[model samples]
Target chain A: DQQVKQNSPSLSVQEGRISILNCDYTNSMFDYFLWYKKYPAEGPTFLISISSIKDKNEDGRFTVFLNKSAKHLSLHIVPSQPGDSAVYFCAAQLKYNFNKFYFGSGTKLNVKP
Target chain B: DVKVTQSSRYLVKRTGEKVFLECVQDMDHENMFWYRQDPGLGLRLIYFSYDVKMKEKGDIPEGYSVSREKKERFSLILESASTNQTSMYLCASSPGGGFNEKLFFGSGTQLSVL
Candidate 1:
């Protein structure tokens, strides 16, 4: 069973627009959510994260929103740039597992300039 | 910046060959992991080590084995390489096995089994 799921396989957005990537988890025990970005032949890099205690966390142009009630989290990239065009993965971890991440299928975001 | 290094960026192995992928961390982290990423399937965990000389199987441990000889190094071994084993392998390390701890990842190794 997939604990974390990213239903959208791909998304296209115009530059300078808002790009939102969504992720859902089934296990209620998962209290930490993270986002990672990956390019071709490269390993994933940390983007942003949100704890279950808070509803939202923002860093520069990136914001992560966690809705504990729905077991859902979303990553918002404002004023999206061409450089942001890549595969984005939503990962989750239970309170017990720590940095052990459970990843989703990932969403390929294409920003049209 | 914490650096996680994988021994190779690319590797080629023949069927039935024993292949070893090595990962090392310089941050004195207590946790290390190995994952394989495939197209459309995302990243799947192969194994993880929480301490020196201790290892645990992750979601997908079949046909694979892991070793943590030292605190900074984690190794993944493929007993027999197959075409299905061709994928990008990633290694990561964290200071502790906490949910909020950030993982430092290596550049990844692309292993091709023919």
Candidate 2:
């Protein structure tokens, strides 16, 4: 069973608009969530992360909101640029198992200019 | 920057043949991982090592094995390659085995089995 799920396979947005991606997890033990961005033929890179203790975490144009009650998290990019087009993956780690991570299928984001 | 380098970007192997995929990291990280990326399946961990000569199985380690004789190096071994094993293999490294540590990944190695 997939502990983490990104239901949206793809998303499209216009440049300078707000792009939002959503993710849900089934494991209540997961205390940390992370977002990774990947381009074609390239490995994924860390984007942003949030801890269960915090409701929101922001870095520059990126913001991650966590709702522990719903077991959901979302990533928002303000003024989305064409360069931001890539596959976004949401991953979660169990609080006790630090070495193992569970990843979602990923959503392909297309920011149109 | 943390540079995790895979020895090969692409490889073609015959079924039943033994295959070895090598990975090296510039950072002196204590944790290394092997994962396979497939459409719909996302990235599934095959194996990981916390330190030299130490290894552990991940979610999908049925036909795969890993070796970590050195701290900076981790190798994934396919004892008997099969067509089903064809996929993008990724190697990653982290400073420590912690939920807070963000992973650094290699570009990836696409292995094709005939």
Candidate 3:
């Protein structure tokens, strides 16, 4: 069973516009959520993360929001740049079991220049 | 900075042949992981190790096995190569098994089983 799901397989947005990627999860035991950005033929790099205690976390142009009640989270990039185009993956981790993580299928984001 | 390195960028093997994919980390991380990434399927964990000589099966460990003889290296083995095992393999490592620690990943090894 897929505990984490990214319903949208792809998204396209113009540069300097806001790009929103959504993810949903069915497991309430997950207490920490993270987003990673991956380019072609490269390993995924950590973007930003939010703890269950906090509803929102922001880092420069990247921001992550979590809604515990709905088991939903989103990664938003403001003024998206062409360099930001890549596959975005959302992952969840259990507080007690820190080593194991569950990842979503991923959403390919294309920022048009 | 933590660096996880996969021995090869690409590899090819024939059916019934034994294959080994090696991964090494510069940081003395206590936890190491092997994941397979496929188109549209995202990343699936094959195996993970918490410490030297210790390993745990992840969600899809059916055709794979792993070893961690040293603190800095982890190896994934395919006893008998099968076409279904063709995919991109990624290795990751994280500092102590602490809560909220992020993972550092290798570039990945694209393996093809013919």
Candidate 4:
């Protein structure tokens, strides 16, 4: 069973526009949600994260919002750039098991200039 | 900065061959993980270790085994390679303080089995 799911396999957006990538999870025990960005021939790198206690967290142009009641979260990038084109993965970490994380099938984001 | 290094960037192995993929971390992290990335499948954990000589099976550990003799190094072994096992293997490490620490990943090794 996939604990985390990214329904859209791909997303395309124009540069200088807002881009939103959605993710859903089935488990309520997850206390922390994170996003990772990966480029071709490279491993994923951490982007931003939000704790369950907070509904939203922002880091410069990258912001993450969590909705516990719906078991869903979304990452919003303001003024998307061409360099932001890559695969974005949503991950959830169990409250007790900090060492283990569940990841969703990534959504490939293409920013067209 | 924490650096996780996979021994090889690309490897090609034939079926029935015994394969070993090596990973080393410079941060002396207590937790290490091995995950495989496949198309539309995301990153699935194969195995993880919390300490030296200790390991735990992840969601997909059927055809794979892991060894962590030291805190800085983790190895993934394929007893018998198969075509189905071909994919990108990634190694990651994180500190072990029970905190929500982000995982530092290696560049990944693309293993192709013929």
Say which candidate scores most in DockQ.
4
How do the residues B1-114 of candidate 2 rate in per-residue lDDT, one tens digit apiece? Answer: 999999999999999999999999998999999999999889999999999999999999999999999999999999999999999999999998556878889999999999
lDDT string for model 4 (A5-109, tens) is 999999999999999999999999999999999999999999999999999999999999999999999999998999999999999999999989999999999
For model 1, what is the alpha-carbon lDDT of residue B81? Answer: 90
| Model 1 spans > 4 angstroms off | none
Model 1 TM: 0.97
Model 1 lDDT, residue B43, Cα: 85
Taking chain A of candidate 3, what TM-score results? 0.99
Provide the lDDT at B3 for model 1: 89
- Ranking of predictions according to TM-score: 4, 3, 2, 1
Which scores higher on lDDT, 3 or 4?
Answer: 4
Candidate maximizing lDDT: 4
Candidate 1 chain B has its poorest 10 consecutive residues by lDDT at B96-105
lDDT of 1 at A72: 91
RMSD of each: 1.1, 0.8, 0.7, 0.6
- Candidate number with the higher DockQ (3 or 4): 4
Per-prediction fnat? 0.70, 0.72, 0.74, 0.74
TM-score of chain B of each: 0.97, 0.97, 0.98, 0.98
lDDT of 1 by residue, A1-113 (tens): 87899999999999999999999999999878889999887778999998899999999999999998898999999999999999999988888867568899899999999
lDDT of 3 by residue, B44-94 (tens): 999999999999999999989998999999999999999999999999998
